[model samples]
Target chain A: MATYKLKTPISEEDTRKLKVNDIIYITGTIITARDAAHRRALEFHREKKKLPVNLQGLAVFHCGPIVKKENDKWIVVAAGPTTSTRMDLFEDEFIKNFKIRVVIGKGGMGKKTTKAMKQYGAVYGAFTGGAAVLAAKAIKNVKSVEWYDLGMPEALWVLEVEEFGPLTVAIDAHGNNLFEDVQKKVEESRQKIYQKLGV
Target chain B: MEENILINEKIVDDVAVKLLQLAVTELPRDVKEALQRAYREEESEAGKTQLKAILDNMELAEKTRTPMCQDTGVIIFYVKAGAQAKGLDKIGYALRSATRRATKEVPLRPNAVDPFTQKNTGDNTGRFVPFIHWEIVPGDSVEITVMPKGGGSENVCVLGMISPGQGVKGLKKFVVDTVINAGAKPCPPNILGVAVGGGADIAMKLAKAALLRPLDEPNPNPDLAKLEKELYEAANSTGIGPMGLGGKITVLGVKVEYAHRHPASYPVAVAFQCWAARRASARISSDGKVEYLTHKVT
Candidate 1:
């Protein structure tokens, strides 16, 4: 219910204070990663090589950006959140390993990620799904990229962003999940609504 | 013998490129209006906010000529080629070429990949990518409709084959259940395409085709139209709302189409399109004239 303007690297205390339904506008450098990028990061971990960039206390967005090459630099033309559930398998480990404080994406993550959020003082912010152009406008620049072999959607994009969201805090550090709560409410009301319709 | 109209390969290529660009950047008029209405009708503050953001995103996308979504999607083209169209043989190649060029130009995300190798195609064309569905009609003009099926909604598409004994009630259950189970994953204020009573594949295709209709239009069949309305109400009543954040507008519209089925089987397919609902259409005549429809400017 409250709106907060926060900059990264966000303190563990700030993340722990967030509650589901709180609005957040983040101004900071956030990296973008999807399934491929997550796998590659894990690969980098196993190989004992340094990641292309440091991730501790940084935010990782679930995005596959549409980027164009302009005069030898990359331009993010349309960058929107991808479905976060696709990263469900890797998120818990990623968060524990990387100390990522904020995860932004669409469609929310799963129970494992929710548990991770609570245990690790992290939060999941749900950007409006399909709002690619709007999301891109928040990104000031594509600072760099890695794992290009993973393709655009799966590449790890290191971007500098400003006031990057009206992102809803969907999963909070207290273990409350907005989506899970909504699902419970709907399930509880489902039969009653059906009966009223005489279906 | 009727003389065949020779369509140059370049014409198909040109039309394909234009159609893809328009589909990616512009919100179809029907969709724009529907989202506007959703913004007005949404009672929840969060739902309203989400709708407004989507509307703003649509406008910005058009202004900047950037894709309305990052997915840019698995490009699917349905072509109704006239019998007299000579380059019917070349249309597939033309589409692949057009898709490849658009990946770099429109800068569509390189979505195509080798399933086995997990390697990106770099271009958007791959084995059966930019998937084409073709039909031969009697005229000398070719009509093409491009639907960019994003992964979020496409992942939630479902096909159910019910026993004929289960009847209409069972079919309704299937559709409602699909939407509810899908929850916020497919992206709400979604446009739902429901196809009933074909074999598995045909049912799925019919469901996708149903999505091409304008949002406000109901099925011509009164019975089907009633079903569409009923499902629409039932879905919204779930209160899954926009982005599944909880709201009154879970879906914008329900479009239903059906095919005759065997007495033993009742098949239902549901195709979910996010609020973006990106599609564009164009027609090319024998004289090499091209006309674009479904885009605001064209």
Candidate 2:
């Protein structure tokens, strides 16, 4: 319901102050990780291997960015969020293991992730779907990348971003979930449509 | 023979690459207008913010010649092969070649993967990738449309086989339920394409084909047009809004297509196109004249 500007490595206290429906613009480092990257992170964690970057207090974006090599430097062309629901399986554990503060993506996650956020003091922010160029505009630099064998989209992309979102807080450190709230409203309307159509 | 080779390989490749560029970077006028209308009309603040971001992203993408979305999507070519056109057989090959070339130039995400090995094709070309659908028509010009359908909308596709007696009402219920079940997953303010009748596979094809139609056009069939309008209204009533965060305009449009089915069957299929509906097309004459149907090219 309110807007705030935050920088990362955010503390638990920073995440705790936000509520579902609050708007936030982040100025910090956020890494891109999708389904494959999520699975690999968990697998690597179990194997007791070192990750390319420390995830603690960072925003883990559910994104598979479009990137290109330009004069030997990697540039992010369009780095919008991928759907987050696909990572629902690993997210609770990801939060528990990584101590990350925010999960950024399109499409909200499920109950398990919400519970993890409430327990671990994290939040879910939704970037507009298909708004890739705007996303790239905010990405000041592609600081580094990993897991290139999983291909560009699935690889771990380290991005340095500035004012990187109008990311609407859909799930917060408390138990509030905006998607669940909207689903209830939709169900009520679905009934009326059925009644009128006699279906 | 030289003329044939030039048209099939070079002209087709140029057209295909340019079409891909335009399709990904620029939202079609009708679809852009629809999003603008949704933005102006959306009452909810969250929905408006979502729409504004979408519009701004679109503008930036166009200005910078960047892909509008990171997904870029699965490449599909809906081709109108003129029976009278020369080198009709090579159109498919040309499209595949063009896909590879476009993949590098436009830098499309390499989406095609070998299912068994789980490895990407790197060039966006693989077995049955680019998924061309061919239609033969009564002219010397071949029309090609490139619709890069994103995964979010593709995941929400549904098929229903209800009792034949339920008719339009059954179809209505099916669509409403599908959209609700999809929630925010498909990215709301979506455009839905519904197909009724035909066999199951045909029904699915018809439904996806329905999405190729522009938002500005109503179904030419009067009864179907009315059905489209009613479904459009029913869908928006769900108030799923942009990204399903809650708002009044859940769907921008609903298009319905039909075929006569077996008396016992009432197969219905629905395909969803997310708010970033992207497509562009061009037609090439047998004599080598090119007409850009969707957008004017310099």
Candidate 3:
């Protein structure tokens, strides 16, 4: 339940201090990646080929940004977090191999991801689900992009942002996941709710 | 008696593009009011915070003319075309052309990809990417509704085939279980459209089409309305709250639509819409006049 101002290239130490339900306002650079980009990154890792961008100590955002090309420059129109769990299968490996310290997305991840967060000293931050315009306003710049062939949603977008969150710490570095907790609580109280409804 | 309404192809094109633009940039009045109501009644600070952010985002998107969410999603057209309307054959081409224009102009994220080869279409339209569903009505005007359903919520959609003996109770259990299982994935404070009794595909279509109705409006059937109310209360009581951080309002509204089913089958489908709930509609008269039903006619 604590509030923090995080400036990236964050460390394992900084991420470890984040507890589930805590709030964080993040600053500095973060990279965006979704399904296809992660798959490509893994392929590159297996081949021992150097990635287009170095991700050490950086945060990764699960987002598919709406960008337009104007005067040879890319303008981010609507950049919001996508569903993070879609990347769960590749995330643990993505975090460990790329040294990603913070993960920003909508929705919380599952057991494997939370386990990876604990083991790798990473925390998952959940942004408001449908707030694309607000997120776009926080971006200071689009530093560069890679994997243009992967398309907008799957491309690697390196962006510079300032105070880029009010993100809820859904999965903390210690493996506490708010989503899992809510599911358990709902299960415990399910009978009472159903009875109240007379169903 | 009506002299076959001569709907111009050009008018259909203009209306379709307008609907796409309006759907992405503006949160309809009913949805905005519902979110405001949820914010007012939310009991938890975390839930309130989530709602506040969403509201702020809505405001910014409207003012700045930016999209509400990045996943402009697959553009779906629900067309209630009139049987007597002229230029019926040209409607599909107009819708597709408008979709491509909107992909660049509304600047919708290029979401259409080749499923087999994994190649982005760059424009949102591919082979049936801007999916169109046609239903013929008695009227002579074409009414088109565009819903920009995001991937997050669509991925969590559920279809269940329950035993008829299980009845309403079984249907209720299926719905509640689906929402709980969705957790933060579909984005809480969601709008649910539940369809019961239709065949598999028809049930799924009914559920999505149900989302076209305003949140303030209840189902016309008393039984369905009652079911919606009960499900809303039960879902909120789960405490999944907004963004699943824990709160009192997991679902803002639920709309139920049911169709007569075969004696041997009872299929239920739930279409989960994220808090964004982006949709808008317009009608084109045979004389080429256009009126936006959801927003101002201008």
Best candidate, DockQ: 2
State which candidate has the highest TM-score: 2
DockQ versus reference, model 2: 0.76
Which of 2 and 3 is the better model by TM-score? 2
In candidate 1, which residue ranges exceed 4 Å CA deviation? A36-56, A93-98, A146-155, A196-198, B1-6, B84-87
Which candidate order results from sorting by lDDT in descending order? 2, 1, 3
| Model 3, span B17-76: residue lDDT tens | 888888888889999999999999998766777898999999998888878888788889
**C-alpha positional error of residue B250 in candidate 2 after TM-score superposition, expressed in Å:** 1.7
Poorest stretch of ten by lDDT in candidate 1 chain B = B1-10
C-alpha TM-score for every candidate: 0.91, 0.94, 0.91
For candidate 3, the docking band is medium
Which stretches of model 2 miss by more than 4 angstroms? A39-52, A146-151, B1-8
Once all C-alphas are superposed, what RMSD does model 1 give against the true structure?
A: 2.7
Candidate 2 deviates by what RMSD?
2.3
B57-118 per-residue lDDT for model 1 (tens digits): 99999999988888888999999989977778888888899999888888788788899999
Interface RMSD of predicted model 3 = 1.5
For model 2, how does the per-residue alpha-carbon lDDT over A1-199 read when each residue is reduced to its tens digit? 7998989898999999999888989898999999999999999999999899999999999887778788999988888888898899999999999999999998899999999999999999999988888989999998999999997889999999999889999999998999889988888887888887677
Candidate 2 per-residue lDDT, tens place, B134-192, comes to 99999778899999989989999999998999877778888989988998888888999
lDDT for B264 in candidate 2 is 96
What is the C-alpha local distance difference test score of each model? 0.88, 0.90, 0.87
